[model samples]
Target: MRGRDEESGEFFSPSRSQNRRDALEVLALGEKLVALTEAQLAKLPIPDSLLPHIRDCRRITAHIAHKRQLAYLAKQMRREDDDVLDAIRDALDEDGEAARREVAAMHRVEAWRERLLADGDAALAQLLDEYPTADRQHLRALVRGAVDERNKNKPPRQFRELYRELRELIVGGSAGTDEEDADNVED
Candidate 1:
């Protein structure tokens, strides 16, 4: 039949081709999801039940089996809330943005470490004011060790450690110390 019926003056429902195209779009989204690493996929707003199907699809090697798995994924997606589709789309789009922000954060930490090493007490004071919870004594020791290593032409172990400590302080370390330890700190 034609797209519209003249007798009723009402538009026909979605055509079969339109329905197929929509299903294909969803399948394509499923394929994109399968391409993602498990950690990336975990960030998606999909149901927990669908995760095993997706992981199974990732493990499948044969073309026919993979195709069937993708079809299953599509079926599962259809049953999930509509918001899951939008969430997947948004997460994929934000991947680049997230990467850029991570790089910027790394650069900022590196700059702070370098400034602390070069500018000495002034930089330390500024950093302490910024990260009030940071251990001032530890930072002073690292700076001293790094300088001594530089003078003696020894391995830059302390320099590396300083970088690591700065990174922890700046990025919010999981096991970071919170004590001010001000009385024990030395100049």
Candidate 2:
């Protein structure tokens, strides 16, 4: 008295296949967004108004994906015990708060970077004047690496270290030595 067919050796669930297709579509959409962003950034006289919108879209996408992952994990929790569901809910709440804090910090960093870019040569010249010993190439590398990590959805450990090193080099006016006195800081 077996229900499944033996010769075909196939499962007959339609919903499962649909779910996989939906996941593939979402992945494709993400790829398209990345490509679009790159193309939009390359245009001359870049539309200043669009930058904030682009950044906002990226943030919203990140937050939505995070929430979706949490929801999926919660849904997969064993239903035998109510306590497991409650724990998952609590954990998700905590994660949401942490994510909000991270987003706020990221926005601050983005604003500072935008300001630096807007200030143009004067800002760069001031940095050079303030930190004569620091290498501009190193500063650029650190900034680029930090941005790349942010774009790749990776942890910020190395990026943070690079940023700190760049900051130290700028503030201390020394490239090799990591010593920085607190008194000279203007920021």
Candidate 3:
């Protein structure tokens, strides 16, 4: 003999019963609505004031039907991987102008990136050569300083003092003076 829990009671089968009841009610209501004339349906309290809602429902139904037809056509056109590849190749061959334009656009982007890399690399290499003894931290600080200086000389706000401060911190370990400073000063 099987035992059921007292708390759960009846095995939670409300969904099946509720779904069937709801579907039957919907079918009956739909038949009733269909039998009513437009004027007769308009007399209904909610429908009388919400003509736009009724129109929107009709539009949604038509859109759903159109989408279903499109989906059926797409499903019917499904093919093997090789067949799809062949079809794509045939389509591309038929559109030679479009293929050429795509290739040209790709080449242009490649050329632009190559130019940017060349310019950036040249600038980075020059900065590295200038600070040959400097470590990675020093190099980053130097680049940051230069960018700050360039930004200050341009527009709304001044940045020369900020650049000088960062430059001093980079050369002289954030504490005070650098090793080279002591060597340069005569006793």
| Order of models, best lDDT first | 1, 2, 3
lDDT of each: 0.78, 0.47, 0.41
Ten residues in a row with the worst lDDT in model 2? 177-186
lDDT of 3 by residue, 1-187 (tens): 3355588765544566776665454344333433445675554432232344334343454667744533333233232243542433333353654465444443433332233234444544543453354354543444455455555665412233333433433343322333332332221
Q: What is the C-alpha RMSD of each candidate to the true structure, in Å?
A: 7.8, 18.5, 24.8
Candidate 1 off by > 4 Å? 1-25, 37-47, 93-96, 147-157, 173-187
**Deviation (Å) of 112 in candidate 3:** 97
Please report the candidate that would top lDDT against the real structure.
1
Candidate 2 residue lDDT tens string, 1-187: 2245578966555466676675554444333333355554453222344344334445555667745543333233322244533332333343654455444444434443443445545554655675677677765666666667778978986567654554445423443332232222224
lDDT of 1 at 42: 74
Q: After superposing candidate 3, which stretches have Cα over 4 Å from the reference?
A: 1-5, 11-13, 47-53, 56-187
Q: What is the lDDT of residue 82 in candidate 1?
A: 73
